[model samples]
Target chain A: MTEQETIGFFKCLADKSRLAILKSLMEEDMYVERLAERLGITSATVSFHLKKLEEAGAVTSRKDQYYTMYSINKPLFGVRIIDILGEKTSESEAQKEREKAYREKVIASFFEYGRLKSIPTQRKKERIVLEEIAKAFQAGREYTEREVNIIIADYHDDFCTIRRDMISEGIMTRERSIYRKAERNGGDPEPAGR
Target chain B: MKNRIEEFENYMRSSAEEKKQKIAEMVRDGRADEARAVRAGLNMYEVMTALFGAALKKTGEGEEGFSREFHILKDNVTGNWKRNLEAAEKHGDAEKVMIEESKLETVEEIVRKFDSLF
Candidate 1:
């Protein structure tokens, strides 16, 4: 984890409500309503906490038909504090700043009011756009083609092209009609073969 | 078995014809978004009606019941998105804040149009 992420992870865990939520998930995966019921909190509150936990990389959720099922990120929990402290920061601040600026420039050029104006023809720029679009997919969740299309269509009109490009570029992978965001370091691993 | 096959074929032919007519009607009514959704088989009400015609009739509210449900769902989603937006702002996560803001704006626009209609 980066310094910012380490801080975010700790800050997210420092809440009683979130800790309770994690405790509940230790038993089994539960949807928002089930979590709410178990904790005696409102569904909205449960959803809010889930969102925070998800951002903190402490919890992961998957689409289960009509509902989203949340579970603890067990691997994340296994990391020792000593390991985190021993890790060297990966990138120089200046390099990170430059990359951030380039990403923003590309996004501003291609996107208009949250919608992509057109797919970029250049391979480099297209890869950046694809990565931005990939953020819509939850890590460790598999989606049907229709579900994938619907999410991609929100960004651009030609979802087919974008979807195909995502697979071709290795940003996502598909097997037996199920789509998953490609695993990266510090990301969720692929589940054992179905 | 042949008779059943013929009956199924006829039913499917008529169903396709009916859907074409419905799409035309949607376009005529200036419901392009809904028409597009119908074309894509993503219109919530149409999908629900197709899946649960008998249950809808049993409810007796039919379309109105679905409309009320849609409104409630939209409002609940709007509430959630607003909270998410607030949280994103608090954390200063620019990308998430932008995504939430855009989503909230789209939902608000849809709600405004829905309110105007009803």
Candidate 2:
């Protein structure tokens, strides 16, 4: 099979239904109606899957009066599969360099390794407060402000200052002795997700 | 079912072998540079992704799927830069050259890995 067709085979197998349909058809040729029924899916879905397989040359179809018969295309299939599962072949060097650079950038950002805190001026007291709140919530059921403050101090010496900064930033609120995340503490009858 | 999966495996091997052969042919015909370039560009991840995408795009045998590379991902560096840098910025992201993430695998490696998983 040509490189283009081989690529197509990989693409076709990307879907579960397509894979199942292809698997089913490996047994024998079947019409759209038959395939849909056997797979417990709609005829439209059947048609869609068949179309992809057909274009990939994984299968072929022909007219049969009101029914359209579909079956696997064995020869092209063999070659395409062999190419994907076989030996190593390198891509263009120029392309590789360009792609590799892009990939590294992605990794660096993810494994930030203190790079995130590289910005010197700490304009974000919000993040600090968020960290405290997040940790407190690690209590799982969520807790009051007193508990959050205690936890913060447990983790940090400047816990009081952080708490004050957070309060000024409208992050947390003191309701009686309980500390709660300002947003989720008391919203409407409907939450944001709803 | 087992036989069909086996057949699929064989097809995958043959296709990859075919690609290697074709690249070898290019090198044999004195197009060494181009052949090397071609070899470097493909990996199992890319091949399977392309194949799966192609399959989905075919007449009615696949579903819509996209590879990792195909999806539009925000450049967080650029996003953060835009958020932070107040100075007269001369450049935006997507234009900037950046290093990619990790040690990439070849197509054969991807298939072997995938086969083991399945």
Q: Candidate 1, after superposition: displacement of residue A180 in Å?
A: 30
Docking quality level of the chain pair in candidate 2:
incorrect
lDDT of 2 by residue, A84-120 (tens): 6674545675466555454444433322221222221
Q: How many backbone clashes does every candidate have?
A: 0, 68
True contacts kept of 1: 0.00
How close is every model to the real structure, measured as TM-score? 0.36, 0.28
lDDT of 1 by residue, A31-140 (tens): 98999898885564567678889989999999999999999999999999999999776569647856766876898789755678899999999998888888878888
In model 2, where do residues sit more than 4 Å from their true spots? A80-194, B1-118
- The residue ranges of model 1 lying beyond 4 angstroms of the native Cα positions read A90-194, B1-118
Model 1: lDDT equals 0.70
Alpha-carbon interface RMSD of model 1?
A: 16.4
lDDT scores for all predictions? 0.70, 0.51
